[model samples]
Target: MNSPPHPPRQALPTHGTTLTPQAFRTLQAMALGGLLVLVLGWFYSPLRIWSNLLVVAYYLVTLALGGALFLALTYVTGAGWHVAFRRIPEAMASLVPKTGIAILVVLALRMNQYGWQLHAGAPEGTDAGTYWFKQLWLDPPFWMARAAIYVLLWSVLALSLVAFSRRQDRLNPQELPRAIGSMKWSVRLSALFLVVYSITFSLASVDWIMALEPMWFSTMWGVYQFAGMIQATLAAIVIVGLLLRRPGRLLYGIFRTDHLHDLGKLLLGFSCFWMYIWFSQFMLIWYTNIPEETSYYIARMHGPWGPVVLVSVLLNWIIPFFVLLPKPCKRSEHVMMKVAVVVLIGRWVDLTVMVFPSTVGKLPVLGIWEISGACCMIGIFGLLFFKALTKSAPAPKNDPYYGESLSYHCS
Candidate 1:
C-alpha cells in the first residue's frame, strides 16, 4: 500500500524567542521563595532537610540525565518527528552541571548517612573477604570519586551535543554540508553517552539511593531507577511543551495534537514499564522471603508508608494508563497535561517512598521540610531550564529533519 501523504510543512518564525519578562519574574519569585522556605526547614529540622534534599537532588539529576538520554535515543533511532520539539530536551539536559553541584552539596552535608561510617567497621560473623570487598567498594572517598567522574562525563557529553546542534543553528540554513557533519558528530557522541550512561547511571543509583539501606539489594534496582527517570523526564517535557503552546509563545503552533499524542503514548508506555519493574522487584523479594531484601519493602509496605505506596501506583501507572489509553485523550492537550502533572507528582511520591523509608523510617512526617525542599529544587530546576532555553532557538531550524518533523502526522 502507498504511504499516507505528509502534511504540508508549517512556517515557523525566523527569529528566536526568549522567555517573556512576566514569566521570568514569576520564576525568579519562585526561586527566592523556595530558597527562603528551604532555609526555614534547615533551621527547623536538619535531618529532615538533608533527607529531602537527597530526594530533590537525585530526582533533579535523573530528569537532567534522562533529558540527555532522550536526545541520544532520538538520534540513535533517527526519529524525525522529534526535531521540531528537540529544544525542550536539550535545554533540560543543560541542567546537568547544576544538578551535579546540587548533589555534591547534599552529599557533603549528609556524608554521615551515606555509607561513610559503615565502611569503617564490618558486621560480625561476616566473611573477612566479603567484608573487605564491601569496605573497599563502599569507601566514602571511592564513592565521591565515582560520583565526580559520572557528573563530569555526563556534563561534557551533554554540553558537547547541545553545542554542536547550536553551532549548526548559527550557520546558514543552506549549509547542508556543515549541518549534516554536525548531525553525524551528535549521533556518534550520543552513542558514546548511552554506553557510558548505562553503567554509570546504574552505579549512581546504587550508590546514591540503594546504598541508603546498604543491606538491601535488588538486581533490578538500576533498571527501576531508569524507568522512573524516563517517565518523569517525559512528563516534564510534556508540561514544558504545553506551556510553550500558549498564544504569543515561542513554540506556539509548532506542536500539534499529534505531537501531544506521541508524548502521551510514551508517558503511558513508561508508566507501565516502571510499574512492571516495581512489581518484579517486589514479587521476587516477596517470593524469596529473604530478610535482607524483604526488609526494604517491609519498611515501605507497612505502617503509614503503605498508603503512600498504593497512591504512587495509582498516580504513576493506573491514572496515566487508563487516561491515555484512549486516542482522543492522548491527543487532547488538556487531558494529557493533567495526566502529566499527576505522573510528575507520583514520581516525587515514588522518590519519597524510596528515600524516606531508609532515612526517616515509619514516622510519616510530611511537613514544611518536604514541601519547601521540593519547592526549592523545582524552582532551581525551572530557573536553569528556562535560562538554557533562552540560549538557543526554540527548535533546530537548521536540522536536516526540520521539514519532515513539521509535516509529521499519524497515519
Candidate 2:
C-alpha cells in the first residue's frame, strides 16, 4: 500500500546513486591511454618531447592548484551560488594525487631537455649581471625541489577537503560545523599554499620556460601562470559541469545559465586580469628597453614565435573581450562554452609561446611526442575526473541553500 504524502522537505538530495559501470570503464581507458601516450613521448622521440611534457605537466599542476583554490574560495566566501557545483570542485580536488604523480614524472623527464637545471650557464661579462644574468635562480636542484613542494602542498589540502566533504555526506546536519571548520582550515592552508604556489610557479617558469632562453625574466610570469590556471581550471569545471548536467540526469541544475553567467564573468575577470599583468610586465620592460628584458618579446616577435604570440593575445584577450563584453553573451551557456573553449586553446598556445623559444627554437617540430603527450594529459584529466565522479554523492544532501540553488535562475 502507498504511504500517505508527507510534508515537503527543504533539502532532499538526488545523488545517492553510485557511478555506472560505463563511467568506470571510461575512467580506466583514460588513465591507461594517458600513461601510454606519456610513455610513448618519453621514449620514442626527442623533438617536442619537452614541449609535450610541459603542456601536460603544467595542466596537471594547474588543475590541482586551481581545485584547491576554488574550494578555499567557496569556504572563505560561503557563497550559495556554488552549492550546486561544489561536488565537482571536490571531484577535481580528489584528482590532485594523480596530478602530483604526473608533475613528478615531468620533472624527472626534464633532465635531458633542461640544461640549466643541471648546472649554471657560464656567464659572459665583467659583472654578475652580465654573466650570471638569467642563471640567477634558474638552476636545477632548486627548481626540482620547488616543483615537488608545490604538489606536496596542493595534495595535503586537496585530501583534507575531500575527506571532510565525504564526512559531511555520511553524517548528520549537526556535523556541518566540523566540515565547515575543516573548510576554514583548508582556506588557511590554501593561503600559505598560494604563497608557495606562486613562488614555485615562478621558479617553474624560470625552470621550464625562462631557462630555455636562460636570459629572459619576467616578475609577472607568476601572475600570468596564475591567470591561466584560473581560466583553464574554470574551463575544465564548465566542461565537466556541462557533461554532468547533460540532458536528463538526477543531479541537474548543476550547470544552469545563471551558473554559466557566473562562470563567464569569472572567465572575463581572468581575461582582464591576465591583460593587466601582461601589459604591466610588457610596458615596464618596454619603457626601459632593458636589453635583458626586451629580448624575450623580441624573440617572440620575429619568427615562428610571432604567430604564437599574436594568436595567444587574440584568443585570450581579443576574442573573449568581444564575446564576453556584452551581458547577453555571459548569460547564455552556449556562448560562454564557445568562448571558454577558445580561451583554453589560447592558453595552450601561450604555453607554446613559453616553451617553443627554448625547446623547439623556431623549428616548430610539433612532432609525435608533443601530440601524444598532450593527448596523455587530456586522458589523465578524463580518468581522474571520471574516478572522482564515483567517490562522492553527486550533490550535498543537506546544504542549507540547496533549494535556492535548485531554483536559481538568471535575471
Candidate 2 — worst ten consecutive residues by lDDT sum?
Answer: 1-10
Model 1 steric clash pairs: none
Of the candidates shown, which would achieve the greatest lDDT relative to the real structure?
1
Q: Candidate 1: how large is its RMSD?
A: 2.8
The TM-scores of all predictions, comma-separated, are: 0.94, 0.85
Show model 1 residue runs off by greater than 4 Å.
1-11, 15-20, 116-120, 124-129
Q: Candidates' lDDT values, in order?
A: 0.84, 0.69
- lDDT per residue for candidate 2 within 1-116, as digits (tens), equals 22123223343345533345697576567557655765665566554665677677777777766877787677656667877777887888887777777767867776546655
lDDT of 1: 0.84
Each model's total of backbone clashes: 0, 1
lDDT of 1 by residue, 80-168 (tens): 89888899999988889889888988887877687654655766543466566666777788888888998999999988878888887
**TM-score: which candidate is best?**
1
